[model samples]
Target: MKQGIHPDYHEVVFLDSATGYKFLSGSTKTSSETIEWEDGKTYPLIRVEISCDSHPFYTGKQKFTQADGRVDRFNKKYGFTK
Candidate 1:
């Protein structure tokens, strides 16, 4: 291990704005904002758009798309051989 060459890893709170979920984890990321967590201590707060709590995949509701259909449509329009 090297000394004085690694980023500081500290406990921080990641807040999901969509679901109002907060999770505490160690990260090297920094932020100017802070918030009080459930432990009654203040930690750096980072707001994110998507998290596992609100993500469709984790919730078992992922959207399905037909990739082959779209490719067939493109081929028909451009006369490309498959």
Candidate 2:
């Protein structure tokens, strides 16, 4: 435990830029912006481009390529039919 050597860790609101989604989380990062959270308290605001709410993976909007077996790939590559 050291004194005066650690950055201030506090709760801040992370804003998803694309979706305008907000969430509260603790971080050492600081910001000039502030936001009123659901708890009726004001905290520093941090903007982020991506979050679980807007991300393709978490939102189930991600596109998955068709999985082809080795044999299928080889056959397709060599123009094999039947």
Candidate 3:
């Protein structure tokens, strides 16, 4: 890796807003917010709307909707005929 040419990669905390789940990981993303991790260290805080912790599939709360083709859905929605 070349120096001064690549973005700074450092540890950052990703927060799932819905579930308040947090995990530390490396990223090039930067943020003004900071958070104290479980290790007693501070890291940049990044807030996200959805994560695996709160996602329906991961939580086993996913709904199995009847799969509808695009044409069928469009026609049904607009009442298209002929």
Candidate 4:
């Protein structure tokens, strides 16, 4: 496409704080923080709260919502007329 008008795409590391998992992938995101990977190379590091490693859905540990209980609580507190 257009030259000199697009963001630079480079290899970056995404670190998951919860699981301490690091993934190397290409992204347009830039950061001043850097870290030495297991391969003895330094790359831009991005700290993330959740990733596939720690995500509930991906790990199959997702919590189920109590829909009926929440509805009852809301009706009792607000006196919902219905």
TM-score of each: 0.74, 0.72, 0.71, 0.75
Model 2 / residue 12 / CA error / Å:
0.4
| Model 4 bad stretches (over 4 Å) | 65-82
Better of 2 and 4 by TM-score: 4
All candidates: CA RMSD (Å): 5.0, 4.3, 5.5, 4.7
Q: Give the poorly placed runs of model 3, Cα more than 4 Å off.
A: 64-82
Q: What is the lDDT of residue 10 in candidate 3?
A: 96
lDDT of 4 by residue, 3-78 (tens): 8999999999999999999999999998999999889999999999999999998999976678878988899999
Give me the candidate number with maximum TM-score: 4
Model 2 scores a C-alpha lDDT of 0.92
Model 3: lDDT of residue 76: 88
Off by over 4 Å in 2: 64-82
- Scored by lDDT, the top model is 4
Cα deviation of 9 in candidate 2 (Å)? 0.6
Candidate 2 residue pairs that clash: none
**Distance from true location, Cα of 44 in model 4, Å:** 0.7
> Candidate 1's residue-wise lDDT over 1-82, tens digit each?
9999999999999999999998999999979999998889999999999999999989898765688789889999999995
Residues 1-82, candidate 3: write the lDDT tens digits. 7889999899999999999999999999989999999999999999999999999989999755545466678888899975
Residue 36 displacement in candidate 4 (angstroms): 0.4
Rate residue 66 of model 3 by lDDT: 47
Model 2, range 1-82, lDDT digits (tens) per residue?
8999999999999999999999999999999999999999999999999999999989999755445577688899999998
